[model samples]
Target chain A: MTEEPKPRRLTPKGRATRDRIIEAATELIARNGVAGTGIEDVRAAAGVSGSQLYHYFDSKQALIRAVITRQADSVLHPDQPRVTALDSFDALRAWADAAIERQRENGCRGDCTLGSLAGELSVSDEESRTDLATGFLRWKDLILDGLRAMRDRGGLRADADLDELALSLLTALQGGVLLSQTMLHVRPLEAAMNASLAYVHSFATTAGR
Target chain B: MTEEPKPRRLTPKGRATRDRIIEAATELIARNGVAGTGIEDVRAAAGVSGSQLYHYFDSKQALIRAVITRQADSVLHPDQPRVTALDSFDALRAWADAAIERQRENGCRGDCTLGSLAGELSVSDEESRTDLATGFLRWKDLILDGLRAMRDRGGLRADADLDELALSLLTALQGGVLLSQTMLHVRPLEAAMNASLAYVHSFATTAGR
Candidate 1:
């Protein structure tokens, strides 16, 4: 789902138009799903003529790929700086809180970006699936990095399988966010995160334990 | 999301036609999302005239409601006789195994029906969200029932919170199934289920544990 790199240079006006199209398409697709939002709707919403829209994005798929990248960036915002600094248990709890807070701020709607994309496109679209998977891996790698930090700092047990634990923690977060979005309640997300955190804490160093 | 109960009376041919429409719609929607699969597509797939399609379902949403019901039924199949009988840790493990086995048999492709529906329709369509939430609740209640059974049998600690545990387990399964389907691997699902199972076992009585 990767698009060709943008042109080497653009006028300020040209850059603004491209950003406008992506922002409009993102909101439209988020409100109406990928299938429900058509190129015409995007062109109208972005206020760009057909020729201009085609100049930036060759097809609807290319536009969607840009949206996915933008959404992924938004989803990973909470983990910035701290993702590389998550050496303590409390840091993990704070990370979870940030995720839950973001969902609550959005009224527990829209769901996760990568998750929504994966659910809609993963089964039918191979290229989109790969793109969504890449987004997930980026998130996963950040968490893995945190766990590795904990291990190096003697916060986690030496034998703990960081890869498996990291994936499990991510699974919990995804599941929790989904339930929270569906039920319009925060408890499910809290419970899922707590459960995963508890699992991570189980591998604490003897002194920490 | 629930239809006014189907007409109390129908001829054999009438019942057959309704069933055919539902089957075709379910397959089509499962392959292409609710928005992607048009009524005309269902009509063609089922070999029904436009009038026949309209006779059974007044609108696409109505047909989707029926498909949601059908998918809910499939998802709840494992909870039938076995849920009432799940009074031990081993029984819970068996339940997890069954879920994983089904996904494995499907090559981890389809993912969770209710989850997919919720992801696509929950935000944009309130009726469908309510329907999918109801389906999730039914599954949660069965797990709650089994946890209650274990509690009453002294298989669980007196202080165990069955409701939270049950929701957490369901959350884990939903997340696991989603990751497994996207990665085309079963480890994420297995890990999530294992973590939940371990939580359940943590409450087990001495001999039962």
Candidate 2:
């Protein structure tokens, strides 16, 4: 599932054009969904002609695939350098807080890029679904790695099922963000993250016990 | 947002025709999404002519609003007589189990009808967004009512914030189901529900403590 994205050896200028198109498609899809966003909308938004759009993407699905890849990278590594430091309970809370804060900052308008994509495309598009599943798996693994670090350092119970715990956090996040986006408030996101953090805290080696 | 659906004093036959249109729109929306499912598709699926479809639904948004109402009732009160009985932990777990079972039975294809709608329509459709928000609030209240029952029964600590707990469960459910739909598996659902349940159980007054 972690298969490398198809390589394209374009000149830097060509790469810039491709990125612009992907960026436009990402925004349009995020706002209007895959079904609502058309090839023409992306072309117009990206300021490219139809042939220019087709030059980079053979079809909307291909463009969506590129968008999925870009979203996976952005979502999983929002603060690329800090994502790996998510091992401690405080760090985890900060992560949740950061997510909630980001949502509030955006007035809870846009759902998580990957999550909304999954909601829209997962049902009808098989290839895009695979990319989304892979994105989620990568996300789960990031949380899992942090749990592993905590256990190694004796901050968590040695016997805790880290995989389940990691998945719980991710699930809470996805669910929380979706609800927040729908309700146009940050409360659901906050409540869900707090509960998942509490769940993770239950396995701590220290005071809460 | 909880405003009564528009009043239309149709005869039984007229009512049936309207219902047929709504049901067809619901299935089409559930399968292909609001933007993807056109009026033509619903008209054809319901075996109604374009004029008949238009007679019932002046516009696609009107039809979608009808679908939202129908989806809310069905999702919130799936086992209509039993939704209110969601008081005990046993009942709560049973509810989660039933949801997981249903997802498995469906091969984890269609997502929660209301959830997917929110995912697609919440960002752009203000009216539909309110309806979706109302649907989610009603769902949270059902869970909240259950937690209140548990606390009143002395099964939970008096200080436990039942509202937060209920939201946590709801969030886990949304996130879990979304992932399950995307990944085409049930583990995310199971893991999310289990963790939320465990979070709920953390407030239990006896035994584990």
- What are the DockQ scores of the candidates, in order? 0.59, 0.69
Would candidate 1 be rated incorrect, acceptable, medium or high by CAPRI criteria? Answer: medium
- Return the TM-score for candidate 1, rounded to 2 decimals: 0.89
lDDT agreement with native, every candidate:
0.78, 0.82
Displacement of the residue B173 alpha carbon in candidate 1, Å:
1.6
Model 1 C-alpha lDDT per residue in residues A1-209, reported as the tens digit of each score: 45544745988999899889988988876677787789999999999999999999999988888777777666456546555456578888888888788788888876436676666777677777777777777777878888998898888999998887887788888778877777888877877887778778878898655
Q: For candidate 2, what is the TM-score?
A: 0.91
Q: Compute the lDDT for candidate 1.
A: 0.78
Error at A131, model 2, angstroms: 1.3
lDDT of 1 by residue, B1-209 (tens): 55633734878988888889988887876676676688999999999999988887899888888887777766456555544455578777887887789789988786437776776776677888788788788878878888898888788888988888888788888888877777777877887887777777777778557
- lDDT value for model 2: 0.82
- Model 1 clashing residue pairs (backbone): none
Error of 1 at B105 (Å): 2.2
